[model samples]
Target: MNQYSTHDTSGAQLKLWDSAGPFETGAMQQLRNVASLPFVFRHVAGMPDVHWGKGATVGSVIATKAAIVPAAVGVDIGCGMMAVRTSLTADQLPDSLSAIRAEIERAVPKGMESSQTANHVKGGWAITPNSVGRAWNDRFEARWRAILARHPKVDGKTSDQLGSMGGGNHFIEVCLDEEDRLWVMLHSGSRGTGNRIGTYFIDAAKEAIAKERLDFHLADKDLAFLSEGSQLFDDYIEAMHFAQDYAVANRELMMGRVLEALRKHLPAFKTDKQAINCHHNYATRERHFGEQVWVTRKGAVSARAGELGIIPGSMGTGSFIVEGLGNEQSFCSCSHGAGRVMSRGEAKRRITLEQHAEAMKGIEARVDEGVLDESPAAYKDIGAVMDAQQDLVVIRHRLRQIINIKG
Candidate 1:
């Protein structure tokens, strides 16, 4: 086991797995702030990719008793990665991947830019596909109606954005593993509807705190939480679970579309049905340290023993398929990715398009100024991150992208 550094805070010790690399002070402060919360369990665990986030540190795992913080889970509920290995080898891919990339972009609506007419939004489905509608009605319709009946504000929003990818860090990629095996990976979450559910609850939590006159002082207002046994808490959990399911379905739909696109471009191929679908941003009820608690992995993946998970790298670097060792100190969690070393705005201002293009050399991805913020230099080294989390997970497959698409 790698030696972990510990810092004593007001309520619990902050366990950090970042001694092998630089630790940001802002993230440290956020971790301490979270640790100071009254209901925080044992201690807050900081992953190697820890960075400062809105209410809590992005890569920190917070296990709490009797309460749940909405913002700590963040607005992008159930945001995660899904990757599937295909029967086709790297050699089977066509020489030019431009057409395949374009087909995927067409099949999945990406980015925030939307075209609107008298009564339609072009960014989402004009007419919901039969498959998408069936999936929603079968899996979500009844539960969604219940949630809407309670929270009327989120009622008007439909599932039109169910299969669409949203802007910012969400992406799709075609990659080759070390054995030259092909895979398709994507990152996304429950779309507009999830955002509505999350925001509504966050505000509701804050209002409850004010109304009940809770005497706790929070470092950030976004840390407002709904206590266990409260009506709002039950409602949030139901809605959150629904959004999580939506996110998984969203990825599955996009994967099906991408596979169809690939079939049009390449020879016959089949995907391994045991593909991975894991969430990095979400909370769940679990047992730990002899008690039940809510474990919120804000920007971390659950690494329960022998569990499979995806740890993606930056646009140009290599990603990994990993197996968990279930280190208890980390609450059995691992870093989501090579966490951003710089903010997007900072990267855009500091990194030139020439440097961005150079960093992405050999990868078939957008190298324009618009994508400068997502360049490899904008993120921490993936190799170093894996090294720091040596006890949390074991690398299974090393994947380098041949083609990348970003929203």
Candidate 2:
């Protein structure tokens, strides 16, 4: 752990878990900015994967008293990871995994734009499945209607995107643990709806600050916030909770579809019944240091003692299933992944197609220029990241992906 004192009158400090490696100067500046906020409680805790983000540094845990920063949660309201252990073993899988990958892609819509034909949408469901429809109608329909009544700008395309995968770092994979046990893992979140809600609230926060002429001046305009007891604050809390629920349901729907697709090609397999579903990007009220505050984990996961979390590496690298130790100093949080070491644009310009293919040599995934930005070389070494946060979590299972499907 490393500490940096801003020497500001706010009396807040910056605590970082990157002693095993170095982080960008921009990320350190963001941390300092957050720590300097008057409402920030105690200090700002940064995970080993900390990196520069729009508002706060990614992999940061911010606990604030009577205030909330909408942009700190980012545009992906409930983005996270989910993993399920299956009964299938390595020997059960066929020598080739191309067929399985193809099936998964066919079952779930991926990439920026859903493929479409004259008659119907190709990537998404041409006809909504009964299960998905039932889930939406029973669980989300009413809440969505209520939200739309207030904010019509929220995307109405929720139904079609329920089980579809979005592009950019979101992925589904088939992996094997040390025991050769098979597990299916995926990364995604509330799709367009979450984006719309987050954008609306962020802008609303800025407007509220400006309209009231609040005495707050943020280091980054995106850090504009909503104070407690305000009507906009209540509205944002409601909408944010709804988006989070949608994200959980979205992952569940996709998991079911992926399992069904796998069944079509492989022998019958049963899941362990309990899957770890967690959100690394989101905010919730919690009692920290004997005070009720909003804990916003941006690119960080709740690591309350005995809790299960997933920390994935870039494609072609190993991932881990971890158990949290509930370290209080960190506000019980851990890194989301081997955080990006390079910007997407820099990665594209510096990494070559040949290098990407070589890095992902054995994995069955996209080997083209489209996926070059997410290559393993673009991120920090997972081993170093894990080493840096030994106090936060304990590894339970290490997984190596054999098949990776990137959106």
Candidate 3:
């Protein structure tokens, strides 16, 4: 028996793992638009967390033959989660976590646009640390320059954004697992550089559609795609990969800094070197069914059997560490998070600041109106989302954040 329900449109069948929740109309339409794309290999899969996004629906897995959709990969290339389980337990935590949170915030610069001043250098680092500089120079500099040589428009500000957390859903948290072990978790991406590459290619795709004599016509311009074997396709693939690798290094650098900072307050402990670091909003070629196709997981995780991944909830809610089941029909993918039920604007307009504070009662997090959009109420029921994709993964650890830092 099939594990998924079909949300059939005209072209490719869209399989939905929405057992616990129904599809919203806007999200359904976005899926339909992707399904109708001619190059879609076999099927499109939607996770329980599926929601309307700028190009494609979040939580979608699109496998296409000889084509790639830049918008589907999204602007924040390689955006995902990283988690490290530590030897220390929750009982070791200080009574006042405020100081620890402050240290972490200081260690990792966050939020939008840094003034580059001494007092408050938010967003990018005020001064690029030697470690970050080495990592960039060793791993990224040459490839970045190569990409810029071809598509300089894709170039944007500050490699200092490396190892720093950016604003929005991006955050850093100190969590305690069910067994009460301390864990460090964070969510971020390739930052501004990745956004620039994605935005440039998304437009390039649309231009290819308009300029080239392609037989296909897109109902939605965002659905525009670059055909395989073209110069634009090759360039995008190269640049996109650079962004993805940069993002991984970005997370690694931040994790090291966060761990180093934590040592000041807590007893020294070693981390599980194989910390869970995986990307959600990225694409790669993989074999599905019998076809080797480009599978783009916009808001999904590659859940190949035995692979561990992190699925986090909203602030003050529960999160899970999971092992993939490698369910083939869904392309061995799972939902990235609880997924937003409301847009940031809608959440702020509707969810009261008082309610937000009440919901975050036991947790140390920003309950101000500025972070109101990220309140727990703004997201889908995480438990329900987990239940919906039971076949996709097995839960390893259930974690609750005691200290949370938002960008």
Candidate 4:
């Protein structure tokens, strides 16, 4: 068939494009939760990488009309992918990839620890922050000031957390495209700022319905929604917009640092082709299904016809540059990556370092114990994931990793 079809149910219609396989009970539960939303537009679209996430499925798309699910956007808020094509070819990279990784790790803070001088954990703002955070502070703080003026609880966090990559699936990689052109790709989000906004709004939405006769199961508390006309809803949109901007800026700033780190090894580097930064975890008002609706793409990317997007593979596998097909049934979306087959704890417990090293045989990256949870074996096969969404996206480029940096 030209395009894989979606599953339609009594309450909602859903298009599941999984070249990968059928969903597990956990994933199915999350999908059902999303489908249960009253305002969900048409059917929910589940990408090949569909997996169980905090409140919703990780690789699913939830398009809604009047109300928006803040949990569907999740706490990471603006989590997405960013990649840059550099002028330096594969030949320019040094045989020893350790220094390149070190440079990148040093350039950007990649852990849970604060690199800042002070703490601003109260509300959401950080205390003493880094240059990247400082640059974003003034703008975000102004917006936060306005938000807090109304809801004093919406405290601002430091931007020092902005450029820092968080733990778990988040990563940075130096890859080579099909033609052997070098590219750098990474995944991150709004950090502390987005988390604060998301948490605050989600709590407000839940409390807003505290006394209402809400169906517990039929009413997903996590799917706690904020209607467009409400004050909290407006604040959410504002904070969400700010977080999205922070996420994009975070990726840009980190990418710039990555380029600078690369220059230490290959001085003639210039980023040009294959450079893209996009948000997969945010909401936007758009005309879809013949009406103006707020599209909340939690783990899905905007796959409008012919749009360029990154579909990354596991640490040891190949990623893709895809052209969106704009499949209306899927809300014009596609998978983010090869979804996890198991949780991080499970992967760490089941996969071994030797297996990880074996899977990543050709790639120049860390095979240490800390990354065992990120082993290729821990994820669904990328090839299968791509095959599932044949109707959603067309592969434009196949990328293989050379050097990978993890946080």
Count of clashes, each model: 0, 0, 0, 11
Off by over 4 Å in 1: 8-12, 19-22, 115-122
TM-score ranking of the models: 3, 1, 2, 4
Residues 61-94, candidate 3: write the lDDT tens digits.
Answer: 9999999999999999999999999999978888
Tens digit of per-residue lDDT, candidate 1, span 69-100? 99898888999999999998988987888998
Question: What C-alpha lDDT, on a 0 to 100 scale, does residue 258 get in candidate 2?
Answer: 94
Q: Between candidates 1 and 4, name the one with more favorable lDDT.
A: 1
Worst 10 residues of 3 by lDDT: 113-122
> lDDT (0-100) at residue 301 of candidate 4?
90
How accurate locally is residue 48 in candidate 2, as Cα lDDT from 0 to 100?
Answer: 88
lDDT (Cα, tens digit) per residue for candidate 4, span 37-101: 77888778888788898788898888888788888898888899998887777787778888888
Residue 212 accuracy (lDDT) in model 1:
78
Candidate 2 regions with alpha-carbon error over 4 angstroms: 1-12, 116-123
On the 0 to 100 scale, the lDDT of residue 190 in model 1 is 86
Candidate 4 TM-score versus the reference: 0.92
Clashing pairs in 1: none
The deviation in Å at residue 179 for candidate 1 is 0.3
lDDT of 2 by residue, 257-374 (tens): 8999999999999999899999999999988888888999999999999999999999989799999988878888899999998999999999999999899988989999998889
Q: Over the full model, what C-alpha lDDT does candidate 3 score relative to the true structure? A: 0.90
Model 4 residue runs over 4 Å out of place are 7-12, 114-134, 214-217
Q: What's model 2's lDDT at 20?
A: 54
